[model samples]
Target: MDELARRSFVAAVLGAVFFGGPAVAQNTTAGGVTRVALKGYDPVSYFTDGVPQQGSAEFTFAFDDTTYWFKSAEHRTTFAADPEHYAPQFDGFCAVLLSRGRKVEADPEAWTINNGKLYVFSGKRGVLSFNERPIDIAQRAGENLKQLR
Candidate 1:
């Protein structure tokens, strides 16, 4: 198999062995009203502040059918200008799990910026796994995301 395909297979096997099965689906919306992205963490903070900051409801914006909270009005404006640039990949789902074709919720605190894009993970393991072979995992995750959509 090619390198990407080989990594994908290994990821799937590891996921099965470690997680015992497919990851649980993430909840997109609460009360079917507002869908909070990044669990209320400001997406912009990952890039600008270099840390995850809890956002205030006072500064919120809706994009791609999800409501994103911001640390400040300026951050909200920045996100509104180009949401795709700020939003986490895999719809805020765990990047490592997505490479394994699983849709799992991500922890905003566990994240990284690769190629100027934001990627969030489920926890420490997810972060470490993604860091190992980011390009391969990201490519695989992108393909899996298309299938999921």
Candidate 2:
């Protein structure tokens, strides 16, 4: 890899190790299945409010076998109406890492909205790398996601 690519790879690995692992959308169980998506951050708020807002247990919705919380019932209703629109790309994994063919958990606070789509990052490094070439990274991430599926 080139020097920049090598540095980015290292950053992603370190971020994953220090921060967290790949986030599986589903956290299943025998008693019950409840996986709070985006670490309980209201996905809709990322768009409507332009920031990450902690969700409430009182307003939760289940979609694609994963549970999501909302800051309010209105946000929940908005999400229920059209979930795919508000949901993060790469199933909430770090977008930059996804573009590089890695599955790493993303921090909701380290995120960006591009072309009307929300993309989260492992940290500031990932976000900076993504901002360098968003269209290309997003395209690569989309292709990687398709291959993974």
Candidate 3:
């Protein structure tokens, strides 16, 4: 098959195996629409406010079929300018789990900004584990991500 077709086939297979639903569900919860990204927490606020601020549906944007809410028009504009810079690492998956070559749901409230990258954890333990060695865990997760991607 052609390269494009082969890649599409592989992506489809991976999406089915990993997500068990539409590929867009990788960003949302079970491919549902009401499930907002980062659990409705403003992505920009994590940096600008140094905390997780709940966002409103009024200021929102949809990317990759997942909705991202913002606290204000300014924050929404900032996120629109460059979402990759503000979005949670590993697509909001538990960073510590990813470091161990696993995929687990993350708790938006349990997170940290390390080296300008936002990492969410499944719980307090995952946060502490990731904190123990951010660089090392990041390296390990990077290695795993290569194969997964």
User: What local distance difference test score does each model get?
Assistant: 0.78, 0.76, 0.73
> Among all windows of ten consecutive residues in candidate 3, which has the lowest summed lDDT?
20-29
**TM-scores of all candidate predictions against the true structure:** 0.75, 0.73, 0.69
Clashing residue pairs for model 2: none
Q: Tell me the TM-score of model 1.
A: 0.75
Ranking by TM-score: 1, 2, 3
Which pairs, if any, clash in model 3? none
Highest-lDDT candidate? 1
Winning model by TM-score? 1
Q: Mind giving the per-residue lDDT tens digits that candidate 1 earns over 92-121?
A: 888899999998878889999988999999
lDDT against true structure, model 3:
0.73
lDDT of 2 at 94: 86
User: In candidate 2, what are the lDDT values of residues 6-77, reduced to their tens digit?
Assistant: 455445433443355431123353567666668889999999998899998877665544567889877876
Clashes of each: 0, 0, 0
